[model samples]
Target: MTGKSQIADRIAARGASRSAAAAAVDAVLGEITSALAAGERVTLTGFGTFEAAGRAARTARNPRTGEALEVSATTVARFHPGATLRARVAGGSGEPLGAVPDLGSLQGLTASEPTPVETPVPAATSSVKAKSPGGATGKAAAAAKAKAKAKKADVKKRADAAKKADAKKRADAKKAQKKADAKKSSSKSKGKGKKK
Candidate 1:
């Protein structure tokens, strides 16, 4: 298992665990950090570039005093991980070293490596149809009447519910405002008595 050391350590380990591995990792990370701190960029093959970028100075207001203050320019280190790293992170082939095979075109392949065939099932046909009382017109008229009745019932139910909810809300708000006014008047009377 690879420990939490730098890339240098992993490379130095060479499939063997030793103190030299940690030292190598530390040295490489220290060098990279030093370069970045000094405003230098580092590039790794198949990996992205690392560099220190300068942030522009800006004027910011102090929240406490509402006074404008100048913020000084600063440099921040940033890492752009390489394509191979990104692909690996994103659970891809990470094939920057070689071209990846076209798996999309080879889709639907089985483990036995046999070509699959598409078979269509015939649509079902029903011999007995529903018998209406009179004809299609009678059935449609009956459906329309039922639909209009349902709509009217639903509208009435909804209107009643909304009216009830609005009344309850208004009552609650009035009660809350009355309680607040009473509290405020009580506090004011106490303050006046203390003054006297």
Candidate 2:
């Protein structure tokens, strides 16, 4: 039946025996496995890298009895395709296998590229302000209050002064009227004695 050995012969080309091609493929696989076991990456030209990665410990459940189970942490193999392989799969360049695609004008576009932006920072703590505390706005309000108070005091003083002046004028006019009445009475008495 057709198997891996036949596939290898087809890849290796003319004059390569099935056993020899299989041995070559085994050698390459063995090398990759060994490197991964040693915590090293095995890179294949135009293919990809074979890496060892850790799987974290987790709790799993059994389906049969609904029982909880613990899955231990372990290392696993991971394969990543190379740039040429990715480009070919993506229908980039029409070039043959093992060749990098020419992405004219967009070559360097990548997720890792840096971009510039501005971030705002709050004002410093040392510059903290208690708004309207004994400042110009407060001073203006106090001055207005004091001016209103002074105006009331001045109005009261002027009213009291005018009352005192009016009382003094009434007293002087009453004294003058009493002296005129006294002079008229004395003249009438002198004229009556002469008639007798």
List per-prediction Cα lDDT, in the order shown. 0.60, 0.61
Report the poorest 10 consecutive residues by lDDT, candidate 1. 125-134
* Reference-based TM-score, model 1: 0.38
- The TM-scores of all predictions, comma-separated, are 0.38, 0.41
Tens-place lDDT per residue, model 1, 51-163, is 99999999999999999999999998899999878878799652233322442322332224321222222232122111331222344455668999999999999999999
- For candidate 1, the lDDT comes to 0.60
Top-lDDT candidate index: 2
Give the worst 10-residue stretch by lDDT in candidate 2: 125-134
* Backbone clashes in model 1, listed as residue pairs: 9-25, 47-82, 48-81, 48-82
lDDT of 2 by residue, 54-149 (tens): 999999999999999999999999999998788787976533233223323232233233223222224431233222322223444456679999
